[model samples]
Target: MSKPRKPKGRPISGWLILDKPLDFGSTEAVSKIKWLFKAQKAGHAGTLDPLASGMLPIALGDATKTVPYVMDGRKIYEFTVAWGEERSTDDLEGVVIRSSTERPTEEAIRALLPKYTGVISQVPPQFSAIKIDGERAYDLAREGETLEIPAREVEVFRLSLIGCTPHLAHFEIECGKGTYVRSLARDMGRDLGCFGHIASLRRTFVAPFGEEDMVSLADLVALERVGDEGERLAALDDYLIETGEALSGLPHIAISDDQAQRLKMGNPIILRGRDAPLATPEAYATARGKLVAIGEVAEGEFRPKRVFANH
Candidate 1:
């Protein structure tokens, strides 16, 4: 008789925040990480332009399942605006095609930033990842085709001016998902009666992950070098944050061994053990106090909307 096939090893599952380096697209960064971790399933939560860098969350293994839940969390960035130049990509990496004639004082620029805070409509740059008629807008831009990228409704929760000079301004941003900091810098220049693009950008936070948690390109390259020289890379477990760490900020309930087994059967559970039944579906912690899934109260029954973990 033929020998039975052995099951493949389970993938390492958890969220990892990388300090993205300049010139690397979000997809490229995720690809490198996928190679490094050898995780069968992996994904990134948001897109970052190659010209920008900072807090980028990469979901490895089954952790990719939780990406949607974490995506809506707040984000923070520190970006710079150059006073008199504009480019095709809305950042310095793109060829400069326009220059502004007007110059505004630092204080003048600071006063104008508030008008952009809160809910607003923004037209994305022509050279962007936004899709149009089943084709990438940037691809069309490269084809020398003109596209009227529509204004999108995005929110900027906070915009704080950190420093300023005659030709450049530094600022911090705490904004909702899809708030394009590069686009914001471009528009800010226009608001100042000048044209501008992002010269430097760094992301500091994505809800549960922060700057302190980010692994840098230099660090990853160092690991690669060590492995190339026949040294071991990090331990298999070092990269993992326990599944619960992903939802540490949210409220939770503890399930006993028996209840955990029952949850796997897809049966509805009573709210008697939970902190409170969610009025609307939202991610909630598990009976073991781990973030398990999104739960909702419907017809006096609690049902799981998304289950992020099985262990």
Candidate 2:
């Protein structure tokens, strides 16, 4: 029988809330971070387009397990829509497909905000990452194939017009998961009969993380100047947020060392005491401030679903 292969690099774990710069791909950013930290595993919670910038939460090592929690959270974006033309990709990168001389007034734009807010149906842009018949929509778009993409429901918690000019308008939106800002621009343009496309877009927040938590790529690159490899790695490690911080929205329970051990060994622990929760759909267990496992409380027992390594 063959032995298992040993993983390479250090097993560092935590979240790195990156302030992604414009024109940089999310996957490329993850690769750069992993290499800089010399970590064994890395992944990002959400996909930010190369055209967009700001708050990209990245998980390193064991923290990758909490990515779903972050992705499901709400997000906020600030964008500019330039009137007079619509593009193939619905953004500045694409070629102009339609043009119009008319422009929507500031008052008209503000009046349209209510129609977009709350639960609404939205059609995704053609040059998007959405799958169509087992192939990426963007790939088909690049091949010059026009697709009849279906509309899906997306919740927009709030939508407001910030400022506007004869040729441009600025807006901010807070929305639920799967909301597409590009489609909003396109739909508004088509509705107002002015034709428009996204001139600029920046995501300022992804739920559970905000601007204050973001670290720039340039700042991370500067840490590489430390001469000693160990000191350099330590400097980078200082920026990582605790893995449990990602699960702040979930119910949490503190357990004893014995309980932690049993959870690590894949055993369920009985819930005791008057204050113990009788049942919960999902909850996380911690010991001395370290995450042990994420599980459910049912029938007076805490069942381990996903266990974490000792940090």
Candidate 3:
């Protein structure tokens, strides 16, 4: 029999809400953080395009288990749409495929808002990460292949126009998961008869995280210059938010130390007391304010679906 190889690096766990800079890919940010923290595992909750900037919540070690909860949360984006030409990629990065001299008045744009707000079907941009027949849509697009991407329902909780000039318009949107801001710009341009593309886009919020929680890339880089190795690692560790913070949107239950131990061993704990929840589809269990497991509450017991290691 062969012994299992232990994973390399420290088993650090928590979330890092990054203020992703423009032109930095989400995967690149995760890699950089993982290397800096020397963590054994890491992942990001959402995908932010290289062209976009702002809040990107990254999970390290045990925090990766809570990524789905964060990804399903609402997001807010502020973007600028430049009227005149529509690009093949639906952003400044792509070449112009259609052009129009026409510009929609502010009144016309405001009137169009109602049509896009709430539940509406949106087709993702051609140069997108969406998979098609086991291949990426963007890969096919780079090869000069045009595909008829299907439209899927996305909800825009709120969509408002901030300001506009003859050639440009600024807007802010709060939307549900799977909403595509690029598609919104393209469809709006086509509707107003003033072909347009995303000039700039910034995500100010993603679910439980907001602008206030974001740490700039420059700030993280500066920590590397700390004189002592121990101090430097400590400085970086200070920036990590608790793993349980990502599950703030979900129902939470506090358990005893004994119960926490039982959960760690993958055993269900019986719910006692009248205050205990009878049932919940999804909930998180914590002991002494530290996350222990994410589980389902049913049949008067808390059944763990995913367990987390102690920090």
Candidate 4:
């Protein structure tokens, strides 16, 4: 009398695009995924504000180690900004602290959009998690000390005025990582002479993942109640572009089994065919595919800065 063994849960790897719900922080989504999959390791590609909602990429197990690649991907956001107002938190989360000097027209907003496109320097809102020293900037803001944060360079590949209302304007933005939509709205208000803040925000895409892969909180709750986490997880695969595919834009060079073995043992992969400069040494490795390790180009070899998991 022998009993057959059943597989635990699906050995989920790669990325997960959760349509993060309002009121749930990025960490909460990760927690839910951890409990649902019983994943030993998991992490989000980027953190989302509780007030905002949309595509939040969650990495499961070995996928968690691939977070760095995901984090650097370009982000797309569709957000509504309310004109003639301002908030301390930069969005609806804060109290109204100021009013606009004039009611902005659609033409005015449209005219200003071009200025924000391409590479630009913008300061992140005080109510942000950017760390200065060991403490968060938001923590300092809450403590009532004047925030003296500095401006940073961010690339706004595209900023389009999608729709407009008398008081509300919706914009679609494709920007580099570290770009804050809330700050963009705030700065727009400043440019328009009518201060404004983000009234609503929804991330439409995180580089490769789009609305098609998004999963709402209602769906997650229903799946949890039915004890049917597997089916729900299947719906998420379309959103996860896999870490390797995500980094496909970078140059690649395959290696022999012996070379891979050596690379895995912390040796350089001895890169070839790249006649150009490189970024960080750790930035080249992809989670899937032939990308086994990330390294730097030196005199003649790409020294292993970091190695992907063997399996």
Best by TM-score: 3
Candidate 3, position 88, lDDT: 93
How high is each candidate's TM-score?
A: 0.88, 0.97, 0.98, 0.81
Q: How many clashing residue pairs, candidate 4?
A: 0
Q: After superposition, how far is residue 230 of candidate 1 from its true place, in Å?
A: 14
Which lDDT tens digits does candidate 1 get at residues 132-249?
9999999999999889988998888899989887888899989987788878988888887789999899888988887778887666656765544324335534655666566655
Clashing pairs for predicted structure model 3, backbone only: none
- Span of 10 residues, lowest total lDDT, candidate 3: 271-280
Which candidate, 1 or 2, would have the higher TM-score against the true structure?
Answer: 2
Model 4: CA > 4 A from native: 1-12, 225-241, 254-259, 267-291, 296-303
- Considering TM-score, which of the candidate structures 1 and 4 is the better prediction for this target? 1
Alpha-carbon RMSD, each predicted model = 3.3, 1.1, 0.9, 5.6
Give one clash count per candidate, in the order shown. Answer: 7, 0, 0, 0
Over the full model, what C-alpha lDDT does candidate 4 score relative to the true structure? Answer: 0.77
What is the C-alpha lDDT profile of model 3 across 1-311, one tens digit per residue?
99999998889999999999999999999999999999999999889999999999999998998898999999999999999999999999999999999999999999999999999999999999899998999999999999889999999999999999999999999999999999999999999998999999999998898788899999999988888988999999999999999888878889999999999999999988877876899999999989999999999999999999862
Q: What Cα-based lDDT does every candidate model obtain?
A: 0.76, 0.93, 0.94, 0.77
lDDT-sorted candidate list, best first? 3, 2, 4, 1
Which is better, 3 or 4, measured by lDDT? 3
Worst 10 residues of 4 by lDDT: 279-288
How well does candidate 2 score on lDDT at residue 302?
Answer: 95
lDDT tens digits by residue: candidate 4, 1-311: 87997545455566667888899999888888776656566789888999998989888755666677768989998899999888998899888888855878999999998889988888888899998788899999899866878899999999989889888998889999999899999999989999899988988788666678677666655655544556655554444455555455555555666777787889875555554345444335433354576677666676776676633
